[model samples]
Target: MAIILAITNSKGGVGKTTTCANLGAALSAAGKAVLLVDNDPQGDLTKVMRSDPKSLKYTLANLMNAVLDDTEPELFVNRAVIEGAGIHYIPANSKLAGVSSRLVALQMSSRYRGGETGGTPCELVMARVLELFQSQYDYILIDCGHSMDLLTINALAAAHQAIVPVQAHYLAMEDMADTLEVIQTIRQGINPKLAVGGILLTMYQGRTNLCRGIQDEIQADYGNAFTVFSSPIDFSIRVAEHPIGAASIFAYEPNNPAAKAYSAVAQEVLSYGQK
Candidate 1:
């Protein structure tokens, strides 16, 4: 049931690591089976998957301290895996930005605040890194790290969904009103199985006019909550020379036009995984 997501945007060059490395390599070139999790420590999706995540040595901070000792966390997973058409990677390091204050002080002294933290402390360590891979990938995503703390609150409490690439300037729709009021206060408290998984539009130029007036002011305000991607991603130059030239405009041109606008935003995210 892997459908995680969480591409986030508290604001930062607004391509969110090139839309999480070309929508996890365009949903693994549309065959699915992707993974991508680079919870951004400025690793830039493991340096655009060209390696040198400080020369890796098992990352995701040893899968968050072996899921805080309950262990069995994919045995500190490390594939260093590099497939081409059906993406898979967990390679994010800058030492994962010192794993958010040791996972917010070890889930703040734990009693199960959420799991390792306990009592649902905003989805404790992203639900211990999504219960060790959420039954192995079909799509996990998560490329955050623009800011909000605790690694964007454990990737929006381990996401059930979230996109927001944004960029067409003019304060990118006023910084998406504080990231949609912090995703509407994390959907009123903490993840109500989350949603808003759309709103891409990165780097667009559309022959200017303030980039089509900020895409008609982000579809005249949130466009009925969200769902904007109708192929926009522009301002190429091979996606601005891929994170210091590693690669990803779905490997430099999976049929251009910003890789077919992330393959029509990954087929509008597989039509929301068929509802």
Candidate 2:
């Protein structure tokens, strides 16, 4: 079985997609078969993986549609996946915005009609879909939308673990509390096996007092509660530029500080998952 992980933060601009792209690449480089799932409507992770949303013939939207329509899982799974940059992925686009509604409607209809007991729930849609590929990949990383919507809920419900990429800033820390609360809620009701893989501090600047203070505060508050990764991803122009170039940091600038940090984080993830 694959270790399914959701790279998510309720706050936007917290480097969630960037972490997913780079970390997936780093894991792939380490010889792990990785599948990156773009769960955001923006398709940033898809683009970073070098797949254009406009050019994509199939996406998460199509897969979800197939799942709800009772189509064969293999057909949509094969059609939606695209391989690139040493990884495979199911891309997402703006059409994914409608998935939440469709899922909700399915749930309501199931309740009203007293549907079959084995039917998948709204929150487990992604989980059910990904199970078809579990034997094919070692790690499945989901880049989630920046919200506690149905999409993010599906990602959390599907994941065995979650990696939260928090920017070293006060507002990001504040937003993290909400994210953690939602994770706790999901664990309590939806996925009891889900665990927080780690809290990754991103865009960290060692010289900045504000960054240091924020990091210190996070460690003080969450250190005992979760594993805050030792190597904070440093603020790097190289990291920011890679997405625009449709490449991962490892591929664009392997020696960059941010790249090394992500590599270390991937190793940590692998080690921790083993436990």
Candidate 3:
């Protein structure tokens, strides 16, 4: 079985998508089979993976709708793009926005119908679809949008673990609780096996007092309650300079500080399986 992970944060600009792509790339470089799922309507992950979301013939939305419509999802499994980066992925597009809206409508209808009419609860749609391809990879990293809508809920419901990436800033640190609360809620009701993989501090500047202060504060606040990765991804222009469909950071610039940082984090993540 794959270790399905959701890279989620309710706050945008927190490097959620970047972390999703880089971490999956790091894992793939370490010889792990990785499948990246673009759960956001923005398709940033898809774009980063070197595919045009709008031009793709199939997507995460199509697969989810198929699961709900009782169509065989296996047909879509083979369509995962085997990018040059060595990470396979399912892309998403603006159509995912429609799927998100439909999930909400389904939830409302299910409430009124007492859950008798819906085939799958809105929160479990992604779970149902991911189950079809879980065993094919060692890790499935889901890049969730910056909202706690049904789409995020579905991602949480499907995930075995969550990697909450927060920018290394005081204001961004404040939003950690909200993201963790969502994970706790999902664990309580939807997916009991779900756990926090760790809290990753991104865009970190080690020399800056502000970033360092916030990092220490986050460690103090969440260290006991959750795992705060010892390695923080350094802020770098190279990270943002990765062109579409380029091999991961390791492939883009193997010696970049951010790449080294992500490689360390991947080791930490791999340690979890040992424990």
Candidate 4:
């Protein structure tokens, strides 16, 4: 079975998609079969993986439609996956924005018709779709949209764990309490098996005292609840340019500090899985 992990944060520009792309690449480089799922409507992860969302004939939206129709998941799972950068992924585009509304309509219709115990709700659809691929990959990484919407909740419901990438700044650290509360709520109500993989510090600058202070504060506040990774992703121009080159940091510049840092974090993740 795959260990499904969601890379998510409520705030944008915190490197959630970047971490998902690099971590999937690094894990694949370690000889693990990886599937990166773009759960965000923005399609940033899809573009970074060298896929053009506009040209894709099939996408995650199609799979969600099939799930809503109660079709066999196996019949449509492979058709939505695009292979690139040593991993398989289901791309998402703006069309995915309608899925949540459709799911809500389905629930309403079920209530009116008294059909089949309301079927599967919107929040559990992603979990059902991912169940089809549990044995096919070693890791399934979901790159979530930067919000606490139905889509993000579906990702959380489907995941075995979550990796929160927080920028090393005072404001970002202050917003983390709410994000952790949401995760805790999901674990309690939807997925009891969901664990916090770790808290990763991104866009870190060692030269800045403010960055160091925020890192120390995060450890002191949440270290008992979740593991805070020691290897912080440093600020790098190469990382920003990775998507344009259609590659991960490990592939774009193997010797880069950000690449090495992600590799170390991947090893830490592997060790956690072993335990």
Q: Give the per-residue lDDT digits (tens) of candidate 4, residues 1-275.
A: 99999998898899999999999999999999999999987899988888888888788888888888787767778799988868889998887888877866766776777665455776799999999889999999999988888888899999998999999988887557778889999999999999899999999999999998989999999999899999999999899797465669887689999999999999999997678
Candidate 3, residues 1-275: lDDT per residue as tens digits?
Answer: 99999999999999898999899989998999999999999999888888878898888888888777778877877675445457788899998998998888888888899877647778899998888877788999999999999999999999988999989888886678899998999999989999999999999999999999998998888899889999999999889777644746786688999999999999999999898
Instruction: Give all TM-scores, in the order shown.
Output: 0.36, 0.94, 0.96, 0.94
Best by TM-score: 3
Clashing pairs in 3: 50-245
Q: Which stretches of candidate 3 lie over 4 Å from their true place?
A: 80-83, 244-247
Name every residue pair that clashes in candidate 2: none
Misplaced by over 4 Å in model 4 are: 106-117, 243-245
lDDT string, candidate 2, 1-275, tens digits: 89999998899999999999889988999999999999998899888877789888799888877776777767878889998858899999888888878877877777887864355777888988899889999999999988888889999999999999999989888889899999999999999999899999999999999999988898899999998999999998879786455568877678899999999999999897467
State the local distance difference test value for candidate 1: 0.75
TM-score-best of 1 and 2: 2
Q: Would you give me the overall lDDT of model 3?
A: 0.88
By the lDDT metric, which is better: model 1 or model 4?
4
Tens digit of per-residue lDDT, candidate 1, span 33-128:
887777877687777767777778876766765665556667666453445435777777777666677766665666445445433352466666
- Off-target runs (Cα >4 Å) in candidate 1 are 1-14, 19-37, 40-44, 47-49, 52-55, 68-90, 93-122, 126-153, 158-163, 167-182, 185-187, 191-201, 206-214, 219-234, 243-275
Q: What do the candidate models score in CA lDDT, each in turn?
A: 0.75, 0.88, 0.88, 0.88
Residue 138 of candidate 4: its Cα lDDT? 94
Ranking by lDDT: 2, 4, 3, 1
Residue 65 CA displacement from its true place in model 2, Å: 1.3
